[model samples]
Target: MLKREEVESLVEKPAPQFVRDVLEHPPFRVTPNTTLETLVSYLRKFPVDVVPVFKSVFSDEIAGVVYPHTGLLIKSKKLDVKIRDFINSPIIVKESWKIDNVLEILASEAKWGAVVIDEEGKYVGVVTLRGLLSALLLREPKAKSVAAVYTPVEEKKSRVGYVKAIERLSKIFKKLAGGEVEGYVVLNREGGVAGLLTVWDLIKSRRWFKGGGEPRPIFGRGAARGEGRAVGVARVWRLMFRGVAVASPDTPVDEVARYMATTGLYLVPVVDKEGKAIGAVTAWDVIYAYLYGPKEGREDVEVKRAVEIPVAKPQVEEAIRLRPSRHVTGLRARDVMLTDIPAVNMRDTLSRIRKVFLRTGSNILAVVDDEGRVVGFVTRRDYVTYIAEKSLGYWKRQKGKWLILREQAMPGEQAKVLVEEGTAADVMKSEYPTASPDTTVEEIAYKMLAAGTDYVVIVDEKNAPIGVVTKDELLKAFKERGRSVKVGELMTPADIASAELFSSLFSVIRKINAYELDGVVVKEGGDIRGIVTVDDLSLRPVEESLRGERLVFFTKSGVLRRVRAGLSRLRYSKAGALMALDVMRPFDHATNPDADAREVVDRLLEQGVLPVVGDDGRLIGVLNKMDVVKELARVYITYAMPERLKEAERVEVKSK
Candidate 1:
């Protein structure tokens, strides 16, 4: 409806902000020759919501822009395809075109977003529907709040002139007395919005940068480099075709650990309705979550649980039950352990204890005196060193015979022969990192990282070992905590059938993810055996497609395909039945696809069954089995959850 002259005036009045003005251009533009793996790095570095794909026709002019979201060339599993193959016509708009016209065109097409040549048919700045909408409806807090505007690294402040945009936002907020704009998002030289400098963002940034504390060189440098490369890479991997696995707060403790070991993901973002990211569960957090998490219903939790144990000394079945009694205890040291016991003495000759160690193969040998208290703990590494030092003749002479001696060994000789050695008094590190039984799994993890140890002996108020914490035990705890709870009570006979251990890891993971339950129970012949946690499932590796990692799958009316990484906002189907909104929910703020395939695995671990939705809101691929596991390792630790969840329900809830 606008005339050319008017449009020209509009474009010219604003003046064409060169690519340098708005584009972030730090790592520079990627060419068609770039590989997809490298391309993925580019996207991650820029942090640009999307990256710009380009084909060079000449030295200066761009042939077209590749919509990284929709472009398959960037995601081709082949990794050898020329990036130019994915090029689409650039959605160009002249700086002179009225913003209103640009809006109108975007609205009409609904499909197209990028605008290329302007009314004068000359190269102009690019514009997207969401960005323009954000610009036009600047006053709508909800809209702006929901629709965060981000630019690919190749198109950030360095490429285009967004100084004007920042100025505008600044002025509006200034006029409103610091109340108009929530905060201004600034793109770094590479084009991605480097960080949300919201008032909150500003506070956090200042605290981090200006705190005048000892600095971690690696963290600081990597963070800066990451921001610079964010923009270019942002748009490049727009599709984020992969899926996520998730679980609920109430999932069992053991199952979460299993998922982590199996899936190998560091964290899983927790979400709620509206698909907003709420909180996150990391591998370490899983252990603490289970130990410190509320256990009103989990009173019977344990590892290597004793089955059919005679409560009152019934007729012994083969003298004794070989099964180690499983005991679910609190998070701290001494809460779930046996304390008083005779222990190996470091002063004794290695040969004397070798027989005992050979018999038990217990990794930890607590060195104590006649008082029956722990002095030092020698682990398997120590014994390995002792064996390695022995002459081959000694082993050959001994053969299967056991040797026992208590001869004195020099301190220096012992130290040289032990992998890690100390006297009963010196070698015993804090047998138990002091903590209450009520401590949560989240809290225990921080303590472990700080203490630089994997094993934490649980203790009572009296500082005795009620339980022992080890890497394997924590792994189980992490797996269990990641599994959310089911609508019904667990531990009941009827509920035992719904446990995950009875089903394939994939199916249980899906149930944990779909139903948002804790963990699935393992059942052997209708009896609860063990459970698979989110971490266990997440750590399990699976086969993948060529493009990138596949998060989940979809099958409706006989179609099955994997989810891609960059195309998080899209759903692919040969049937052509999926809608844009379905894809958008996972990426864009409007739809809020809170849980991805990774998160779904967490859900399945908790619940016995998972719920899925596809076209017409029908169930699609259950996201069970090896499919979701394919992309498990790709998940990172610190990525923020979706922004649309209630505070009390997310991972942050524990922090708060």
Candidate 2:
């Protein structure tokens, strides 16, 4: 029983302090004379965005700023260079300035952090977007549930299967890596949460045969001597993490965040009382909660306010004129859609579909009719499931049980027959989400989530597919709404996970799995040779191997060697052994350190990780989706929807 005025007061109460309250005192300082090598060491020890540079140790006078990313970019031979040679001008702000004013300055000028000064212009401390957002979240009242910010299980495109499906590891790998989803949830026969499987599990399970004597060479040719079974052959139950951390829908957002931060877990499955996964609470969700508060119910106050207040005729007209009648401001589907995606005819054979998927590295493709009008969509999962079913049927014809197939052999002939005869229309999904070129990114995001799809086909007036927007494009648009941070500011250190040119494939797989990395840079003599990603390891090779095809191998003598083997026989190869040149994509898709993070996101949408290069063309750092998401959370806290709209309008006006 609160009065109307009291409720209004509660809604309009002044927020807590934002700028000075979140000032961060850096652990150390550097002199302008510090060597690039010294700065690199300091950055490694203390992972701060920016380190203050002073004229001397005793002097409080600020010079410039140096960050870890730029320091790492310095060539090994040039480590002796002084810090002054590559310093960035610091954005200075007074402690007395209001939060909004500071935010405006930071949003427009600073890339990573700003130098805080007192009224007398003396250095006080430093303030980063992340620090400010953390302070704001800490001050916020804790009443919201994790559900308010979590991505529902449907939206995550999570695949659920019985624990007994552990034998279908090869098929599972195809589903996991070939689509938007990254993890799989294992359930008991009763549909209770049993375990979890991820790409890390697949990579870690890869092993070389140690006990088996020399394998017989195929066709009397040199075979991979120590090559063992493929990760696809490993039992899923053995590879999957046994226990899963879970949260309830009603769990407090803060509590979930605390657990994730403490346990170093990025995703927590939200389950019901019956132990059924309903959704997932990820670190990004917690960040969203902290920045935007609750996801729903905020519009109710605005609606009520509009109803209570009397609008003047002129004001009403002005509001109507200003409101967007169609698509809202910001990025639209046309701006982010991919026009070069592969499409296939409905009558096309499954073999053609498989070739297209492997050649283009696409998870989904449009299925078109005689008139070239899109009739449906076919995904990697669809193809794999179809082939698996055929194989199972063939095995049953032999009076065999599914359990026996695990220890004996897969029915490769059945899968081959389906690939050679089955048509796209046999397995294509007809009902899918659709959008127009003019649709806003926000609307597309909702459509994707509602439809539980990774992509939405953008169609023309005739319902012909013109372009397609995927989750990667939507994520990029969301990132653009945040502060325009630089790629260098958000990228992770590259040294943590990397591979040498001649390193064993098993070694590379072990490194990537141990670090849970999407990819690792391949370096030769301290120079980047190329990059390898989980997709490179999982997509074409595993699919081709599972089909029992003769894998072509190139010998060091430039001779063509074709080995009719499965994944098990090809496991023990060097990084540069089997089509390494073709396996690794060229490193030409790199971005400069000073490039906008959105640019990095764009590149990462195609490449799992993007290299950040310095002015001298040396690799600085690497960026991924998670890196951008972390910074996006901080930017959301700095600017609300209204502020973002205003900024967009300003840009539009300038464009005009």
Candidate 3:
């Protein structure tokens, strides 16, 4: 837990100036005509996760940002599809805006990053979550212990045995997707921590399948061709990555956060002296600590100090005056409720519900009767759970037939058939929470959180569903409440993985996979050499393709080139012979520990990770986009609706 003095000091820090002070130059932008395959290859080679889309290479007006992971999930052979087809509107912010205001905007927008423009609306650069976190770490003072912030193991309730069958893992995953559990802690035979699993691991495992379809088996000499067979019968151990980074209860919160940010692993298991998992610290836990201070009897002091410091009497009075009233003055269910979400009938098939969800992008839908009165609620998670349970039943009754059916079924037809067999009534929750059209947003938020439901139906006097309010709408209503916050108050301490320059490619790959890292810093004795990332390895695509595998070679001019090699020869020879320097790129991006957080945010927007350097130019820490977003979310929840936080705390305690 943070000492009283430390908490006070954090609470008193002043906000940074404006967005212009930390503006970054856009690293690279692409035209809308850029192909998905081209973008994938570019992302593989570069560290950037999102690329800004312009009408053309020379045009100044922005289109949107393209995230490559979504495109990677496309199972179709149409790699030549234009990026315009995958674009999402970018969150636009101005360089002249104050830092507090911009922070509120980004937090409310809930995007990976926001695009920055000048007074003339000309693109200047981008500010990303990573950059925000890097900026925050630069100004951070004393650190707090993980025990002060980590969610206890008992509260997670998503554990699995390493040897559990693949069929049984789906239920736990469904819980995770539904927000019923935080994450899964995989335990070994002796009950020791074996590994960790999250939704990302599931996504990564299905990368070979296009659009959640059947696996495409690759055939070649020395190539593993039984991937389809393995998927059917593999144990949890096959999907869970080992060598997970762990933390003790006493470890500093920032240290664990830094490891998570840089390594791409969000949850770190908290183990005891006996190496048994006791609890877990996630990015959210760390952010909550930064915003409201430690959970161990210190939040009162922190919240009081934070509220009194930046907010003046007039602002507080105004806030109180503007608070939602039962009679009038603020938004109610009718004002914020979404009326366009599709409704399903009790007799509707899961297949039709799935189609409606896909078409509308709405997670929650109302189940209505022939009279148009809502009887229950169904969610995307319900459909997912139903399919998983159905698959498990099929595997138990006709394991041989199921495997044969899977192999013969068209890409998505088998899954469709499973859903078609079930009706909406089979998975609907009849006791879902509901609210009147006149209910205030405050009441609605409290109801949803307290009831552990994502949405509430807004019904008419006759009990007919008219509109619905989900967490998103509630958040949107109070998005502008955050103020006087800075990046320094949110960033974690830097702790990253490193390897020797002479390390074999095989050893490096093993280390990367074990830690689930995007890359590692390669160094010589007492000196830094370069960095190597998953993009440099190019193992996934090569392993998936039946054609010749490509080996990376650097020219004398330091340019990277790919040379095709036979699968057998490449597999047997390169593992031991190749070295880190053979594929490593020169490390160029670095930020000062004393610089404004915006500078780091700018750098991070351009580069996936930023290395923090001290006055002496030695590496101090690293920051990534995921950790920054977690911090931003903390700011959003705490400041946007301060009055609701106390009730939220009660809900969390009761749920535990």
Candidate 4:
């Protein structure tokens, strides 16, 4: 390790950095078979930022990554899953890449860190996004221009609403996905921004529903008030309770970046004199300021979706009445797109990327130029690869064999200064996924499934990104086309893993990541008693002072009234105490598999997701809004569009 003097000397000399210099040898070792409870304890013990997962204690084969967010989920039992499914793919990089090249990879890829490998592709250590940013930001301190770095007046897009349901928010997500919008904004009746909402909000709500809080679990509840986010009601105001943070068009870019680095707030809403939201800025936009210059234009898309109620022609109405449910047609990618176009100019800097990650919670991003043309793309996976490769370079230079640990939070204050100074053109991937507005729903669906991405950028004749198509948007398009299908035809299977009611909340949360289901069935022996979701696993931290000296356990054998009387005693930190049954939602809200798909979909949108049980009365699957929409799309594609395509092709050929 370098001494402060050495660090100072290296700074003065402008010495190059390698992956080894910043590689963190994950302090904890984990395997596929590790229990959620054990993993939670390990995380608590290690108290680190990220952890590497191996196939097992004895195997060297790498699996995926467990981030800090995972730890928080574990504490709340929202991410109950096995170690295997809980981790994300590790970004890998060669050891020989230069520091600049490595930084480029991390930035363009939008990753926090990566696994390092040597010439033989052997694991060396891990390198991180923060480490790289610290080095760069520290080295280059003159990266002013926060105003220029943010989204231009027209490009900032965050969906703002008075109050809406999860279903409504989902629609916004699909729409804004094209614009590459990061989150949804809830405004007061005065049009003043109240709070922000992202997909993470849903995930957090899932945990909160279970009576869980960060680092601890609270049993005995009636869905605590002020916890926000009402799933049953269409009103959205119930979900947003946090304080709003606002920014203006003239706020300096560096100030915003520093705010993000310290507060973890990546998306800041830009408001006018009346406090109505105009645009939003993210950490990525600030970082891009150092990398790219600016864009000139009025935004080409609507931030709020327009409700264009089409007048029905008598012939069209008759045709619609006569058409089969599966024969729905006439919708295109443009019809479903929000058209905000999520892209940054080529001159944007990489330093402000952390804000982007937090704001959008997405790994993939589109890079554009002054003309709003899509020029490149970036993803977190790419950065992981760069970090891995650079670590080897550092290892070779140091001739060292020790693993670096997160306990030594590095890339210190110096690296950050330099990173704030780097440019977006220095990192973005010139090659990326793109689509055309005229693309059909079926075609777009196949494209997304093939690419394994949720969204695709839409470019115009000049190839400038004008919109995006996402799974959510595709679902919206299909629903508007209308459909009649059986619930059995399109539900996501709930046969994913389950945990006993008595299992530690850790075990239930573990199943979340391990199985990839938003929620899981809770069983008491052979009988299903309840369901647990990530929403139930989150809570505002308990006032530790409210906790008593001893643990209080709840049992079903006692009368409900008696148990309710003794409810206040349970109290402790999130990691050590808590069980799945404690955070599981009671066996309420379920539907029969034979219900009409539309009814099921309406139920999903109106109330919330529910379990689908077979005639035998066993939980078989889940019917959510997405499931209904996906089925709608699949049916239309199978029976409706091929002939439409053929007829259109015939017309084109005749014209030619």
Counted clashes in each candidate structure: 168, 0, 6, 91
Arrange candidates by TM-score, highest first: which order? 3, 4, 2, 1
All candidates' lDDT scores?
0.33, 0.55, 0.52, 0.48
Quote the RMSD, in angstroms, for model 4: 27.0
* Worst 10 contiguous positions by lDDT, candidate 2: 300-309
The positional error of residue 48 in candidate 2, measured at the CA in angstroms, is 65
How much does candidate 3 score in TM-score? 0.36
Q: Tens-digit lDDT track for model 4 on 526-627? A: 467766554233211121211222322222223222111101322211111235533454544678777766554444533335678777777777764445
Give candidate 4 misplaced runs (Cα > 4 Å).
1-18, 25-30, 34-51, 58-60, 66-80, 139-143, 152-185, 197-208, 211-245, 295-656
Q: Per-prediction RMSD in angstroms?
A: 28.6, 30.8, 30.3, 27.0
Error of 4 at 271 (Å): 3.3
User: Please, what is the TM-score per model?
Assistant: 0.23, 0.29, 0.36, 0.35
> Candidate 1, after superposition: displacement of residue 370 in Å?
38
* Residue 99 error, candidate 3, Å: 4.8
Which candidate has the highest lDDT of all?
A: 2
- Deviation from native of the Cα of residue 399 in model 3, angstroms: 38
lDDT of 1 by residue, 524-584 (tens): 4443333333322221121111112454423222344444542322211101111111111
Q: What are the per-residue Cα lDDT tens digits for candidate 2 across 1-656? A: 99998898688544436557657776777897888667655544344545789989999898888644455333343326788877778888887776556655654443446888988889988875445433434445233676576666566333333334356665565554432243566665655555666543433332211223344345433455534223334566776654355566666666555444222234566666556667676555565566556666421111000011111222212211222222232677899998877799999876577667656667678898999877888866456545444432111101011111111111111111111256899879898888889876666655654454457889988877788887666666656664566777767666644555555444555454433345677766556778877554534443233223465544323466665433322211110112222234455588877888765565686677787667776666777554543343333323334566899999999999
Ranking by lDDT: 2, 3, 4, 1
**Backbone steric clashes in candidate 1, count:** 168
